[model samples]
Target chain A: MRVLGIDPGLTRCGLGVVEGMVGRPLTLIDVNVVRTSAQLPVAQRLVTIEKGIDAWLDEHQPDAVAVERVFARSDVSTVMGTAQASGIALVCAARRGLPVALHTPSEVKAAVSGNGRADKAQVGAMVARILRLDAPPKPADAADALALAITHIWRGGAQARIDAALAAAGRRTS
Target chain B: MRVLGIDPGLTRCGLGVVEGMVGRPLTLIDVNVVRTSAQLPVAQRLVTIEKGIDAWLDEHQPDAVAVERVFARSDVSTVMGTAQASGIALVCAARRGLPVALHTPSEVKAAVSGNGRADKAQVGAMVARILRLDAPPKPADAADALALAITHIWRGGAQARIDAALAAAGRRTS
Candidate 1:
């Protein structure tokens, strides 16, 4: 399955697309960041982000999109902006009827590095090794985005099946 | 100037539109809430909200938009969703090149009532009195939305001038 993962942020939103299945080797399709100036107002910044994500979605057209979940308890200063960016990402993907999943930071780290509490360097190293890249992606956010895609490939299948089952059960009950 | 105020939330998003200037008596053009089922996924809920806001904008064509600023430090559990909703609201306005302003809770309260720390009932009462409504809008969120519009009418002029000056200064420096 093809997946596009996003590390959502107002300043620099990371985007990475990966193609793979659970057992097969993954291919890196694309990796980039959408940067916005802090000098701009939040509304304008969101418009920039929305356009950026829309362009990416149009180009990649991934089957599923993975976004890093924002936790208000973490990072008091940037949490609001992060959450806002995440919302845009979710809406962009969902607008096209693409399935979207939210993976926590720890989930991405553990999926790629086998450690929930792995440091940035460790997660970056694992992502690079897994994708057979010469070096880890820059700006850490880019690497995190790749890790999220890998996590979705590894976990999204099972999650999708669970969701389907739940829907079926709900239909039956109704 | 007419202003559309949004109280962003995932479940019940409050919307109010008021038309007037800083000193003149304000007229309540519309007041309502866009509600989504909690059982729905976040992305679907956002789509509902986006459509709702779009309809309002199409119908009213307000000169400016005022949204309640979401603070990460407040209400940890719902802060993420609130921030996300606020982001969508901002983008919806900015995409149309409409002037958008974010009013903090305290600022909205202070603009309508005499105190910044006034309770919900107090703020609602003040909003009713100012708008010449027989009763405050139902659902505190609805009243709060009206209050936000009232605040924008009272304060948006000064804020717009300040933003324009800052933009001009930035252009000169660049």
Candidate 2:
């Protein structure tokens, strides 16, 4: 399966695409950032983000998307922006009829670096090592996105089985 | 100045544009929704949002944009999507060099209804009264967006003064 991972931000969103199957090594397809500015109006900024995501999707055509789940905290403004960005990603995935998987930051880190508390540098290094890249991914967020995709793929098998069991159980009860 | 307000959401984002000076009654230019479906892919949904925002901007040419600040307390996946959508709005505005303003939900409620704890209907009714509209804006989110813009215009005067003070201080120090 091809997975597109996104790290959403107001000014810059990091995206990574990888192709692989369960229990197999993944191939990195592309990674980049969608950037906006503080000076621009909110509507225009939204447009830029939308356009960037659209272009990426058209170019990569990943089978599935993995996004980092946002945890709420203080800084209401930041949380709002992050949530909006995440909504855009989900909407984009839904628009294309593609399945989406969300992973927590700790889960992604643990999957990539064998530690949930692994820093960005550690995670990047580990992603490069796992993907067997000649160099680390450019931006740290991109690497994190790649790690998120890999983590989803790794965990997807068990989750699918559970989902199947749940569906079957529902059918029997109904 | 013309200000665009956005109530960002997963399926439908409410948008409103108003034009006026600070402390003066504002003119409503437009109000509408940018919608996406669950069946579409995440990337394509972003594109739809971008196009919607761009079309609004092209038609209205608002000088500034205001968006309701998000606060996510539950649903990690949903929060992430909301953040991404908000980021798209920020990016769209920034690209156009229009200033972006953020308002908390309470701030907007207080501005429109004089009660921070006001419900949606109360706020919407107050907005219609304040703007002298024939009726309250349709869709609670749309009304909220309008209130957000109005609040920004009202609160932004103080922000301008603060900015001017800082500028003067810098000049004196220099």
Q: Which stretches of candidate 2 lie over 4 Å from their true place?
A: A1-4, A9-65, A71-129, A133-143, A149-174, B35-46, B73-78, B157-174
Q: Tens-digit lDDT track for model 1 on A78-106?
A: 88999999999999988889989999999
lDDT of 2 by residue, B100-134 (tens): 87788889898778899999889889989978899
DockQ of 1: 0.76
Per residue, candidate 2 scores C-alpha lDDT tens digits across A37-136 of 9796555656676678778889999888898877676365666655566666766676777888778899999888889999988999999998899878
Predicted candidate 1 versus true structure: per-residue lDDT over B89-124, tens digit per residue: 999999999999899999999888879999999999
Error of 1 at B6 (Å): 0.7
Off by over 4 Å in 1: A158-174, B157-174
Q: What is the clash tally of candidate 1?
A: 0
